[model samples]
Target: MKDSWRRLAERLGGRLAFQAPLRELTSFRVGGPARMLARPEDVGELQELLASARRERLPFIMLGGGSNLLFDDAGFDGLVIKLGAGFAGLEGAGSLVRAGAAAASADLLAWTVARDLGGLEGLAGLPGTVGGAVAGNAGAGPEGLGRAVTRLFVLEGDGRARSIPAADLNFAYRRLEGLPERAVILEAEFALTSRPAVEIRARLAEIRERRGGQPLGGRSAGCVFKNPPSISAGRLIDECGFKGQRVGGARVSEVHANFILAENGATASDILALIDRVRQGVLARRGLALELELKVLGPGGEVRA
Candidate 1:
């Protein structure tokens, strides 16, 4: 199987990411390595790669900027495809902004704001790529990314390209729960409001400052658990007295219980175990089970159980 993939890579003139360490790609700096990492130069290349993987029945993952993800220590054994140059641009005018999937969320938001776009300001400081943001329908306060998304261009699981509308797209709290797992977001067109660039810039700065007030920016996924209706996950964890709890190298952030920090040789397993403890603590004390916002991918190239 490895030889076949290698031959394919050679034919395509694309480099392979063999035993690529997930720790290096993620914000947490944890997780095991992936068996293969493939970066496609264009959408055609991506589709061809997916077709080959499907034909070979090889399991694979579509990796974005690796911000809102937790990978296990076992490492993935399948292919990991990360989009590049072709899917990392920003260009648009009027009330619509066209952004590439691999574009950083911060950069996309900034681009929109520079044009005086108002809708994306709510998501100013969110991490990850535009594709990840769209896939997760990421948001802050009472707004979500989907609210601004008018149309999405996606590479389907069947190696086909199609356009989907916001009405047809399904989204939930921190989850682009409805899009087919096999589909890859290529670019997204957001319908936003025009405002003064200065005002938009100020709003962006304000939100950045707000996120700065939280326990973010460490080697950790942005927010570990999603807030339940009418309750914040961080508050619940803090109320449970689980803040600053440590297990091995993983520590629940004292500043924000929802954030689990890794220090001094923290492993993916440590973070996973700490997550379990936090969830258990919250459930035991508040009788409320919290859901994780970060997608936990296991080693051996499988989604976390």
Candidate 2:
């Protein structure tokens, strides 16, 4: 396997590593190392890397800003591909904005606001890249990134590149459905509205202020669970007296119950255990199962509990 990986790295020209540490790459700061890590410069490089991985029969997964992900302590045993600086392009033409999947959500939001694009102000303080946000349908309240997206460019699992229109996309609460297996989003175009720059900045400021109460200073993966229909997940957890609750180095944020903060020396297992405890508590007391908004991944990129 190491020989295969070495050959693959040589074929792709460089920017590859063996047993790369993943804890610092994520917001939670608790993951282990990935067996192989690849940083692809552009779409062409990404496609080549993907095809090579397929031919080599090596598992692969994409890593964006690593904001809402939880990698297991054992780490991923496959190729972890992260987009490089070449994929972070952002530009706007009229009310239509084009952004690379690697572009930061905050950067995209700022670009839109500078051009008086009103729709993306809601993404002002959101972490992660534009692709991750769109993939997860990230939002504040009922509004989401999908609503602003008009088109998407993706490299599908079978090494085919295609553009999908918003009309054909299926976006749900906290998730985008119907994407082809192993597809990677390369770029997205958003249809925004023309608004005054002052108004856009004010709206952005308001949204940022609203998120101020979240435990921003701590190491957290933002919200831990998705809000149940008509109810806030944070409120539910707070009602269950889970604020400041701790399990090992992981603790529920007192500022916001939905956030689970990781202290120094926290392990991915600690976070997972705390998540299970909270889920069981919420289920036992409220009779409602809190669904996770945070994505948890095992060593093989499989979803973990």
| Alpha-carbon lDDT, every model | 0.82, 0.88
1-305: candidate 2 lDDT, tens digit per residue: 55756776787666888889998889998888998889988777788778778987778888898999999999998889899988889988889989999999989988887777889876877889998999999977666889888999999977799999988888888899878889999999999999999988787788889999888899998898999887899999999999999989999999999999999888999999999999999999989988889999988889753
Q: Which parts of model 1 have CA positions greater than 4 angstroms off?
A: 12-14, 300-302
lDDT of 1: 0.82
Each model's TM-score? 0.95, 0.96
Where model 2 places Cα greater than 4 Å from the true spot, the runs are 2-4, 11-14
Residue 255 Cα positional deviation in candidate 2, in Å, after optimal superposition:
0.4
lDDT of 1 by residue, 1-305 (tens): 56767777786664566787778888888878887788887877787788878888878888888888887787787888888877899988788889999999889887877677798987777878998888878877645788888889998888989998888876666667557678889999998898988888887788778787577757888788888897888888898998888889999898888888889899988888898988887888889988878888865555553
Which candidate comes out best when scored by lDDT? 2
10 residues in a row with least lDDT, candidate 2: 1-10
